[model samples]
Target: MDTLKQQMEYAHNITLENCRVAKPIRFTETSSAYGGGAEGLSDGFAAGFLWLDKLGLAAKYQVTHLFRQSFFGGRYALVDMQLNPNPDLFLSVLYKRLVEGPVFQVTSIDIPAQLRLYAHCVRNAYYRTSWSTEVVRFGGDKQTLAIMHLFHYRVSY
Candidate 1:
């Protein structure tokens, strides 16, 4: 309908086409756990963004940033999501329905991740989660407060 929408549509088409065209014959993983790599980002986060981009949701959600954070006045856990359209909405978040462990402050950006790929990051020592699926980690302290980034765009005539 408008310039932004048009661009989104075009980008969506390109992403889907590229995914289908490339059709990753196999899945390969480069773990940041071993040796050295990026920082705080994960292979899955990267893959997930690629897949979401292919599905056209990345643009819709404007998932510019994602990560867990201490929220509810530092009483509960939250997800600090950020987008280009509205950066403020990207405040401390706690999207997960089930929050494990106590709330805590952000100690460091990426104390344990090879590549920062999560939505929010803090040193595990400062903030811990017992939930196997609820833990937030970074490869190292090099990563930014946000986990990872997935940039997008489109041009039409």
Candidate 2:
């Protein structure tokens, strides 16, 4: 499936059939880098958004582990040899820090068809703060009304 919706459906069906044992599912090489050189680093924002969505999907499917193939040295590496972090690296960090909560189903009437939204609760280790951040990521050059959305959802105890 070329679209995220299709990918999510595929994953959901597969998980329903094969997730009985809770066995580890390894999602490796989650980078957008294909070859080497500038092209490898060309994924930019779209890639980052896709990566974040993939993480959410993985978590929704109860994926045990998600690994990034190349952190450095590769064309799609998170940082260059000098250790300066790339744009996607920050997204990776955000995923790690904010995605500790169990995945929950969300429904939105306002979201456009082309846009995607993913939500997760704050990790307990963090402070007892309720912060809701709405991120709007424009897809492609069209700059359509539909875009990517990342929400830090909260539940008060």
Candidate 3:
């Protein structure tokens, strides 16, 4: 579901210093002619996860699976899924179990109500950035069962 990506991005795109909204639904900015900011952009994706983990916010959902489907430009990405908010301790352990420490691929977990989501990167690794997440209920359970799509993208400068 696109909303998963959008929600992740919304929780991620906040300015840590001021807590301001930093991402839009799409990118429309012009980049440097030669493109130098690609490194931070790349690391940001993975860093987003680690940041969320550090804050104990990443565990809100199941993240039943994650997969890397398409890679264009200089990036490769994986889509992750979660049934709903579980807990931060679980998220931290689960992420470490699936992504790091052991490494779990998206194809490894299969469940219904499943759809794909993606993260395009421009960096070499996730250890070099500062980003995080915060999850909350979608007003109520009604919102989750009713809405199937939500989208968010960031235009980096």
Candidate 4:
């Protein structure tokens, strides 16, 4: 996880220094070969993507594959060859539904390394209200906690 963080920071710095106009970094392909099968793959994917979103470093990122053949022997794909959704697919959906643009900085004092929290604007159809979403991950567990707060404002005509 630290390595992932370092790599992002390095990339962000390099882009800032080298580019004439700022361009958001995009991860064309990223995958984890960790040994815990689909569950492990989901954990890695969520961690990396959420960290990127938290830092506002990525404009876009694509996972390695949507489907992998049985003979491929890698859990990187979002689905099996038969089109069955993997845990990563569900995570990706939830992220898309919950997180929107304008990332917010989250600060903590001596928080445990295992706990991560990211805040973003909630995706809403209505333009008159405000919403906040928090994405939290605890350790390497398969569970992700998402907390969303909605604030409504009335317009006076």
- Winning model by lDDT: 2
Q: What tens-digit string does per-residue lDDT give for candidate 3 at 1-157?
A: 2344456455444433345643222222211112322344432343343324322222222222322222223221111123332232344344453342211122313322332222222123465532222222212223222212232433211
lDDT of 2 by residue, 10-82 (tens): 7667867887754556677666545653543343555665566667667766667777778887657788677
RMSD of each: 19.2, 6.0, 19.8, 8.2
Per-model TM-score on C-alpha atoms: 0.19, 0.68, 0.20, 0.60
**Which parts of model 4 are misplaced by more than 4 Å?**
32-73, 126-129, 140-157
Worst 10 residues of 2 by lDDT: 148-157
Against the hidden true structure, what lDDT does model 4 obtain? 0.49
lDDT by residue (36-88, candidate 1, tens digit) is: 32222322243233332221222132323332222211212221223121111
Give the TM-score comparing model 2 with the true structure, all chains together: 0.68
Instruction: Please give, for residues 1-157, the per-residue lDDT of candidate 4 as tens digits.
Output: 5575567668767877899977666554454434434545443455445433333333222121222222233555556556676555566567666657665665655445755554556678636544453434444645423232342333211
Superposition TM-score, candidate 4 onto the true structure: 0.60
Clash number for candidate 1: 29
For each candidate, what is the lDDT? 0.28, 0.60, 0.30, 0.49
CA shift of 75, model 2, Å: 2.9
